[model samples]
Structure formats: structure tokens, C-alpha cells
Target: MLVAQSSDVSTDLGVYLPLVVMFVVAAAFAVGSALLGPLVGPSRYNRAKLSAYECGIEPSPQPVVGGGRVPVAYYLTAMLFILFDIEMVFLYPFAVSADVLGLFGLVEIFLFIATVGFAYAYVWRRGGLDWN
Candidate 1:
């Protein structure tokens, strides 16, 4: 009985292998640079270096919790902006694949838009969008 040699052995480096090797090399370089940096760089440490500097000005003393009371409207506006921004991010992928998704995708997106629009309307009615 003769043994047959495997013919499926790959002679070429796979597409993924190059990516793996690239990542490995990048990691090695990063680690090596980080290790070498402290050894070769200056070892200066002083009181001035330890102090916190704020935009070419001295740091001001303030309460640990916060400096006086601030308006809640500012935070509400920022939160609403972030909420809509994240909704946009979710919709982008669906928009890009609209052609492949066909009518079903259209229905899904319409439902999503309606839900988000209702939320927006509710916020508007509750005065969450108001600046003052």
C-alpha cells in the first residue's frame, strides 16, 4: 500500500498571515520604544514639574464637588445632542445597505425613524430641548 502525500499544503502566505505579522511587528516596536524611552530620556523631576499648570495660568482653588451651582439646561442640551448623534450612527449602516436590504429594510428604517421622531416630539413637548 502506497501512502498519498497531502496536496492541500499552502505554498503562499495567507492574506490573514500578513495582517497578523504586521500587528506582531507593530506591538514589538511599541513595547521596545516604551522600554527604551525611560532609559534614554531625561530623568528630571522637580516641584515645578509636579504642579498642575492651566493654559499658561496658575491653577485656581475650588470646591472638591464643584465651584458654585450651574444651570441644568446646559447638561440637558448636551445629552440630547449625544442621543441624536448616536441614533444617526445606528441609521448610517442601514442607509448604506438599503439597496441590498430592499423593501424589508425600508420598513425597518421607517419604523426606526417613527420611534425616534416620537421620542423627539416628546422631548420637545417636555421642554427638554429648551435652552432656558
Candidate 2:
């Protein structure tokens, strides 16, 4: 019987030096921009600029009875936008690799599109797309 001895292996910390440096640089740049923005940016402040922006609507000086509640339409529209946006995000990868993915991928993508289409139809029926 022959006994084999394994040599001690040391982990190299230098491999991660670039990553650490990059993170530090990014953090420094963000902090520097935030700190410099207030100083370098324009300080011209008027009533309009100081007022709370509600889309393009003019802000009332007096507060509303219920703390000025925003309309549900704003939120619904935002959610619908996100839903479709995520669908597009999923679609890009599938489109890029469609040939490699073959029939199974094609079927899966169609199912996904169908599901999204159903949701779109439901929203349309519910008047979610209506501006007013």
C-alpha cells in the first residue's frame, strides 16, 4: 500500500480585489454625486417648484379632508404597465433562443402570451384602460 500526501492549498484573496475596488468606486461616485448635487444644482425655488407635484394637475394650497387621497386609477394603470413590462422582459430571452428551444419553447411562449392576453381582455372589460 502506498500513502499519498495532499499539498496544502491557499485561497488567493487577490482574485476579488477588482470586485472590491469596483464596489468602492461605485459607492464613492454615488455619495459624491448626492453630496455635490445640492451645492452645484440651481437653488431657484418658487411656489410652483415647492408645491407637491400631482402629475400635471395644479396642487391645492389647502389640504383635502382625507389627507388628499390619490385616485385608484393611477395605481391600476401602474400595475398594468408593470404586468405588461414583465411579460416583455420574459419574451426577449425566449425570442433570442427560440430556435435552440424548439417546439416546446414555442408552445410555452404561446401559452404565456395567451395568459397575458386573457388578463389584458379582462382589464379592458373592467375599464382599467379608461383614462376617466
Candidate 3:
């Protein structure tokens, strides 16, 4: 017959008391600032502050117009850049662990690239690359 011996393992709740106290203090300070700001801060509004003034000179009385709508091409170009950039980001970690990941990693990466390649082809066919 073989006998196995086990050592005693006990966790002390007092070890975590300091962390709990710090969290409570931080939360109280944050809540106090949020509640105090509106009551103590400025409540009055003045015309001078409300109207736009150009450096020490009186502002010209002109109608303010909203900024023009952004071009769809700009958004499309940005999205394309972000999408390809993210693909490269995923490629890095896989490359670093390639030996350990082996054939499974290779197959998964090939599938990922094929999917992204299809998306790239779709973007190309839709005239997303044209700058005009």
C-alpha cells in the first residue's frame, strides 16, 4: 500500500482588504467630483461668451453654416486601409507561433487569406480603388 501526503493550503481574506479599501476610496472621490461640479461651477451665461469673438476684435455679424458633408470615397479609403492593416496584425502572432501551430496553423491561415483576398477582389471590382 502506498500513502500520499498533502500539505495544508489556507487563503487569508485579510490579504485582499487593502485592495478593497483602495477601490472604495477611488470610487468615492470620482463620485464626489461629479456631484460637486454642477453645484459649485458657473451657473450664469453671458452674451459675450455665447457669441463667437475673433481675438480682441468684435466678430462680424454673419450667418454660420454647418460644415459640408464628408465624401463617401474618404470613408471607403479609410475602411480599406483599416481592414488590410488588421489582417496583417493577425498574421504576426500566427507567424511568431508557426512552429508550434504547424499544419493546423498553416491551413487556418490559408483559409483566412482566401477570405480576405475575396474581399479585396470585391472592393477592386466595385471601383473602391479609384481616387476620382
TM-score winner among the candidates?
Answer: 2
TM-score for each model: 0.55, 0.69, 0.52
Q: What local distance difference test score does each model get?
A: 0.86, 0.91, 0.87
Candidate 1: list runs displaced more than 4 Å: 1-66
Candidate order by decreasing lDDT: 2, 3, 1
RMSD of 1: 6.1
Pairing residues by index, what is the TM-score of model 2? 0.69
- Runs in model 2 deviating more than 4 A are 1-22, 54-62
In model 3, where is the ten-residue run with the lowest total lDDT?
Answer: 3-12
Q: Which has the greatest lDDT?
A: 2
lDDT of 3 by residue, 1-132 (tens): 955434322245566889999999999999999999999999898997798765565666664476335678989999999999999999999989999999999999999999999999999999999998
- lDDT per residue, candidate 2, 28-102, as tens digits? 999999999999999999977887887787777687798777889989999999999999999999999999999
Which residue pairs collide, candidate 2?
A: none
RMSD of each: 6.1, 4.7, 9.2
